[model samples]
Target chain A: MRLSLGPLLYQWSRDAIEAFYAERMADPVDVVYLGETVCAKRRSLATDDWLALGRELAGAGKQVVISTLALVQAGSELATVRRLCRNGEFLVEANDMGAVRLLADAGLPFVGGASLNLYNVAALRLLRGRGMVRWVPPLELSRDDLGDLLGEARRAGIVLETELFAFGRVPLACSARCFTARHVGRPKDRCEIVCEDYPEGLPMASQEGEPLFTLNGVQTQSGAVQHLLGHGGALAELGVEILRLSPQPAHMGEIIGRYRAALDGACAETAVDRWVTAPLCDGFFRGAPGMAAAPDP
Target chain B: MKLVCPAGNLPMLKAAVGAGADAVYLGFRDDTNARHFAGLNFSDGSARRAVAHAHERGCEVYVAINTYPRPAGWRRWQRAVDTAADLGVDALILADLGVLDYAARRHPGVRLHLSVQGSATNSEALRFYADAFGVERAVLPRVLSMAQVERLCEDSPVELEVFGFGSLCVMVEGRCLLSAWTTGESPNTEGACSPARAVRWVESAGGTEVRLNDVLIDRFAPGENAGYPVVCKGRFTVNGATYHALEEPTSLNTLELLPALARAGVAAVKIEGRQRSVAYVDKVVRVWREALDTCRRSPEAYTPRSEWMATLASLSEGAQTTLGAYDRPWQ
Candidate 1:
């Protein structure tokens, strides 16, 4: 199976982001998703910069996909998405229906991002008709749910690629309010760029002191990283065309390397766990709570 | 502007219609709708009665089959659309693209309103729904500021509806997975969030603790008001301080924005509580209906009455309310 790097959900310094991508130019990942999927206020990389980066990655033989904002509320945001859809050089990931409409109207083939919430074969078929080439199901779907959907799609003669969010902190929700700013007692409009400080997002814990969620601007992600290195074989068996590993602050290259090695049969699938420092979970894969971890196979 | 109120059952439907609701929205008893709560929503017989009752009062009935249909249960959602259309409801409030496609093709005469769970926040998205499925009205998710809403009202190809009063959802509807991440059930798949069967409330010496699937969502101190243990509204610790990191336990009350909404030519205002009691449906719908009437009579002279505001406040979640994302500062 091919390995892909998901979009960066956290806000980092421009230099840090550029340097991160520079390092990924030689990483084992075959595909890379570029652009901001969270708050529009995050301008670490402007639209031109993202396009430049995509070209650099594309030149290096890695497939590049431009990811759009998951929540499109403002006219300016919609305009930005329109520009991204018209970026002729690379495929765009439509996170919301606005982007989907723009890309579909242009007859540009795109990836249906996880936030599109495709839960059934019929939804998949509709997007396919709209020129969607690949789809990332919402993070909450189980392996069985996906298997059933894909099975139905096959029976219905629908053809499209499937990408699974196999690793990193699972995005749990997105809101208009910037939780990162709110945590520091600042309004979303007048707030300083507080999200830049937390490269992996500000960690939040429950009342009883258990790690719960990661507050990254307007998005809330699971505090524990979702590790699916152990499911490479299962994913391939289920006809998963791509495995998406989200970017983290550190050890991303190493994580990508381990996934490559595991997929290549050079190492055991569970060996990648050594590179993931945070607690790991794969509950959604087993049809259980996402925070619950299934025992390693 | 039209006032669309939620009704989980027949009594709530009658209550909303009696309270001057222009339309009443409800769901089937099964998982086809977003408010698929036990002992809530209507069975086929009750749904028929609800439509007849609201029709008698000159109120429209909209059936919400808003939840995304699972592939295994896709037939159920299609059945719901056919049943609602068969019952002669005014419209079908839908979110799933597959279901919308089915409804538009099979029930050409029935109107289609895009549910808030559809997550269409821009004119382009609205246009896509209108062009593809003939959606007549699109409910905006509670994520846009007032300026954005006004811009949409001017640009949208279809009619626009905004949430007026309800328990607020901090996350964008249909996209949020926080509840599923914790409970393995979600509104998109199962039509429930923090499903009641997984909830546990324990009174302890320190306080009253509410847990979702044994995860401590929030703890209320003695005499502190306790709200439902929704994952978003729960208190959590960030850095070293404990606070409502996402949002507090509150409701969205847009009474003060009635004049502005009316001036913007908003097609309708929706009150969102299909899971609430019949009394809540009556009181909240009455307050919004009066506010809408006053605003329509004189947009320049309209002001929310203190009595209406007080009644809404008392009925709000946690007995408190805010303008939500409509006000710039709230974001």
Candidate 2:
């Protein structure tokens, strides 16, 4: 299985973002997705900067893909998506249908990101006809659901790389309202870009004080990190060509190294769990509640 | 602009039609639709009655088979499309591309309106649906502002529909997994959010605590009216402050913007509660119908009457309403 780094979902300073990607260039990840997938207001790195970083990553022998915004509401956002699709240098990850259509109209091959809901084989088949070379299934899909979809795809004679979200705090929802700005008592328009304060996102808890979600600008993420290190064999068996690890604040290189070790059979799958700081959850993979952690087999 | 009302059963369907709904949208009694609540939605027989009643009154009937079908349940969604078409419904509102593809090919003559759950926010996405599946109309998600909606309507390939009134979905449709994170089901996969089966309302010493699968969504103080326990609307602690971190319990009311919507060429205004009561359908549809007719007659002189606004607000979640994302400041 190949290791891929998903786009940065948090807001960081341009210097911090450059340093992070520069560090990631030496990491064991094979494919790197660069661009802001959360809030469009985060201009720590402009479109040109993202393109440059993508080129730098490609120069470091990493297959780079640029991801578009998950929710494109304004004409300007749509225009940004168009510009990204026209960037012929790197493969584009179409996060929303608008990006998908732009790429399809241009007849460019693209990766259907997790935000684009492809629940069944027929939907995947439709996108395949539109120049989609690979797809990351929705984060809510279970192992059984993924297995069923792949099985149907095989029966229908459709071919595309399957990339699964293997690690990170899974994004639960994206809203037009910025939760971070709301937390700081500001409207989304004049909020002064407060998301930069929390590089890992502000944590939210239930009334009982249990971790519930993380507020990352317009995106709300799972409080518990999704740890699928133990599912390496299952993923391979199910024909997942790539495993995507979302960029976190710390230990991303170490996390990538451990995933590489696990994939290479140099280490036990369970041993990789020690590196994850938050509580572990793989319940969505087990067709159960997302916050639930299934017992190890 | 047309006023599309929601109906869960035969009575609500009749009520909407009788109350001046230009079109009525509903779902089957299974996971084929987003409002897949227990004891809600229409059965096969009730759906046929709904179609007949709405059609007889010159109102169109739309069957929403909008959920993303898993491979194991693909045939169920296809069968729903076939059944809805065979029943002679005016349109089949669909979200899944595969389902849209199937409905377009199998029922070539039937009109297809893209459901809001499709999450096609831009003209390009609408063009994709229109070109790929021949979708006749598309419902824009509630994420867009008034200006964005106007911009999209200017260039959209298909007729545009926007939510005029409803309980607000804070997140973009088809993208929210908050319910699935707390429980195991979501509107995308299971066609339900915070599925009623997993909900528990406990009376505690402090207040009435509402929980979804034992996750405390909110605790209401004595005499505080509690709304449905949608995960996003729940109060939670964020950065040492407890509040409605995402959104408060409220509804979207665009009654005042009817003139602007009409001027923007919005083809339809949708009322968003199939899970609500027959009275809600009757009352809200009547109010929107009157407002829309008044707006159509004199767009320049259009102003929503206070009585109509009062009625809608009285029926809204938390007994309040906002312009939602339509107003720039709401975002």
Candidate 3:
């Protein structure tokens, strides 16, 4: 399966973001989606800069896609949806229906983001009819659930590529209010870019002091980074064309290289065997509680 | 217009109708709806009685089968939906896609309103639901401004009902799992937010602090107003500093914005106090009813009285109110 770098879900400086993507372009990623998928108040990178970066990445032979916010809170957000859909040279990943409607109205092909909750096969076929070129299943979906959807899509003669969230900190859900910022004593309006403080997001603790969720702006993520390194075989069996590696700040390059090595059949099974105790999880894919990391397969 | 109000129990159902609410929205005593607090909601008998009482008043009753339907509680939620349909309620407010599809197919004539927990923020998401399941109306999330709601109403073919007054949800419905993160009960499946079980009221040296799941959210001096325990509205430490990270516990009091919300194409204005006393529901509903009636009569001449504002503020946590995301200049 080809690798696609999902949009960065936190706020980082434009220079940091640009430098990250500039380095990532030469890496093994085939498709790169750039833009903020979490909170919109983050202004480190404007749409123009994102587009310029997309062009630069495209010049380097990576297929580029632009992502809209998970929660479109206004007309200006809708206007951003319009711009993303109408913008040439980049495919749009429709996170909310605003983006989907704009792209559908423009009669342009797009990607169905995980936030849109495309669960059933009928929903998948409906999204496909609405100019959806590929679909990223919602984060909580299991293999059986996806198998059911894939079966339905295949039976209906729908041609669609599926991408799996193969790595990085899992985005559990998105919200309109900024939890990370609010946790830092900031309103969403004056968020002060607190999400930039924790590249992987600030950690949340349970009452008993267990590390629970990572508070990333308005997005709440899994405390455990999702390690799906050896699961590539299962994804290939499931007919998933692309594996999504979400962006994190530290060890991203090494993480990408490991996944690349895993994909190229260069890594031993023992390398991924230790994945169980890695402090992250992949239980959602295994149909268990999202926080429960299963024994190594 | 349907006056949908919260009913924490059967008595609340009676109280809601008595207070001019045309309908009472509630759930079973399970993780089925947004207010799945212990000792709240109904048993099978109460559900039947609630439906019977509302039907007798010539008003409607809806089952808020609105939570995300967690994996552990899916069967209970499924059973709740089945029982609600069998009890013959006028409509069911739903959030989960699987539940909606099941409700649509199983009970063809029962009206289904998309619960705010579905979080259909944009027309495409709304249209996706409308075309798929034939949703009649949608409870709008509290994130939209009046102008933005008007823009949304243009494409929202279904009836759009906005929350007029109550405890404000800072997060978009369905999209929020913070409660689950802290307490393991989400609106999606567990049907509660920062639940009472996780909340603790403790007297500390700094102040009287309200903690939700070990997170110290708010600390007030003795005799100061104490807001309910919720994570987003509490005080916390981050980056070696302390602050009110999310929102302070200020229950939503939009008594002044009824007319603007009506003009913004809101089909129905909702009052949010299901957990409140019958007396509180009576007071707030009567005042809001007067305001809504006045606005409906002239569409003008509605002015904010300081006393009215003060009374509402006195009832609020820390005596504060924000137009919320409605007034906030959203990016």
Candidate 4:
């Protein structure tokens, strides 16, 4: 199994993002997704900068995929997605239907991102007809559910390269309203780049002070980190071709190293829970509630 | 614009038709639809009868097969589509591309209306559906502003239906997984959000505690009206203060924006409450019908009456309503 670094969902400064990717050039990850997947107002990296970065990453012998926005509302946002799709050098991860349609029309091979909501084999077949070569299943899907969908796909004689979201906080929702600006009492249009303050995301807790979710601009993520370090063997058995690691502000290199070791057969399959200090969850894998962490394997 | 009302059962369907609904949309009594609440929706016989009743009253009946079908459960949804077509329903409101493809190919004469769960927030996505499945109308997700909706109407290849009044979904539909993360089921996959079977209510020293699958969603103070335990509407702590960090318990009321929507040339106005009671549907649909008739008759003198607003507010969630997403500053 190969490790692919997923797109950055948090708001980081341009310098921070550039430096982060530059350091990852020598990392063990084989594929890297680049570009902003959240708010469009975040201009840390413009269209030209992303294209440049994609080329630079390609030059460093990494498979690069340009990711599009999760929510496309305005004409400008759709235009940005078109430009990204027409860049014509690297593969595009179609996060929304608009991106998918544009890529399909252009006859370019694309990766169906998790938010595309391809739940069944028929939807997978339709996208495959439209030139989708790979797909990332949504975070809420269980191992059994995915197995069923892939089984159906195989029965229909379609083979799609599957990637699993293996690590970091799973994104729960995205909205037109920027919760970060709303929490700070500013409208989304006039909010002054306040998301840059939280490198990861602002933590949200329940009334009794239990950590519940993370508020990241327009997106809400899980409070518990998804450490799937031990599930490497199961994922391979399920025909998962790649494991995606979402970028965090700190300890990503260590996280990548552990996943690399696990995939290389150096670490045991059930020894991943000890690698992270945060509360870990693999409930979606077990087909139970997604927040319920599977008991140590 | 036409008034599209929601009905969960035969009586609710009759109530909507009698209350001046131009059309009534409903789902089957299974997970094939999004409002898959217990003891709700219709059996095949009841659905056929409801269609007959609505057709007798010059009202249209649209069946919603809006949930995403798992591979193991695909046949159930296909059966639903075939059954709805056999019943001669007016349109099929659907989301899954595969289901749409099936309906378009197998039942060639059935009109297809893209459900909000499809999440076609832009014109390109609408065009994709239109060209691929010959979808006749597309329901816009509740995430667009009025200005954006107008622009989309201008560019759209098919007719557009906008949500007129309903419980507000803060996140984009078909994309949110907060419910499944906590309850092991989702609206997209399981056709229910925070399914009632997983909910538990308990009286504590502080107040009523609402739990979903044993997870504490919120605690209501003794006098603080307890709303449904939707994960997004619950109060939570951010930094140090406790408040509705995502969204408060409220409903989306667009009565005041009827004039603006009419000017935008919206083909239909949808009122979203299949889970509500017949009495709620009867009163709400009557008010919207009168308001729509008056507005279409005299656009210059159109204004939402205080009594109409008052009646809707009484039936709204949390006894509060806002022009959600229609008003620019709310976002």
Q: Output the better candidate (2/3) by lDDT.
A: 2
Cα error, candidate 4, residue B141 (Å):
0.8
Model 3 Cα lDDT, one tens digit per residue, A84-187: 77888789998886677778877899999887666565456667877898989877767776776787678889899999888877777665667776665566
Q: Write one digit per residue (lDDT tens) for candidate 3, span B47-149.
A: 8888888898887888888865433444676788889999999889987766787788888888999988878887767876787679988988887766778
Docking class of 4: high
The TM-score obtained by model 3 is 0.81
Better of 3 and 4 by lDDT: 4
Interface CA RMSD, all predictions: 0.8, 0.8, 4.8, 0.9
The digit string of per-residue lDDT tens for model 1 on B257-288 reads 98888788799999999999999999998888
lDDT ranking, best first: 2, 1, 4, 3
Could you list the chain B TM-scores for each candidate? 0.99, 0.99, 0.92, 0.99
Model 4 interface root-mean-square deviation:
0.9
The per-residue C-alpha lDDT of model 4 at residue A164 equals: 92
**CAPRI classification of candidate 2:** high
- Fraction of true contacts kept, per model? 0.86, 0.89, 0.23, 0.75
Predicted candidate 4 versus true structure: per-residue lDDT over A172-282, tens digit per residue: 998888899999999988989899999989988877776778999999999888877666777888889999999987778877888898788887543444555457888
> Which whole-number lDDT from 0 to 100 does residue B35 have in model 3?
79
Q: List-wise, what DockQ does each model earn? A: 0.86, 0.88, 0.27, 0.81
Candidate 2 TM-score for chain A: 0.98
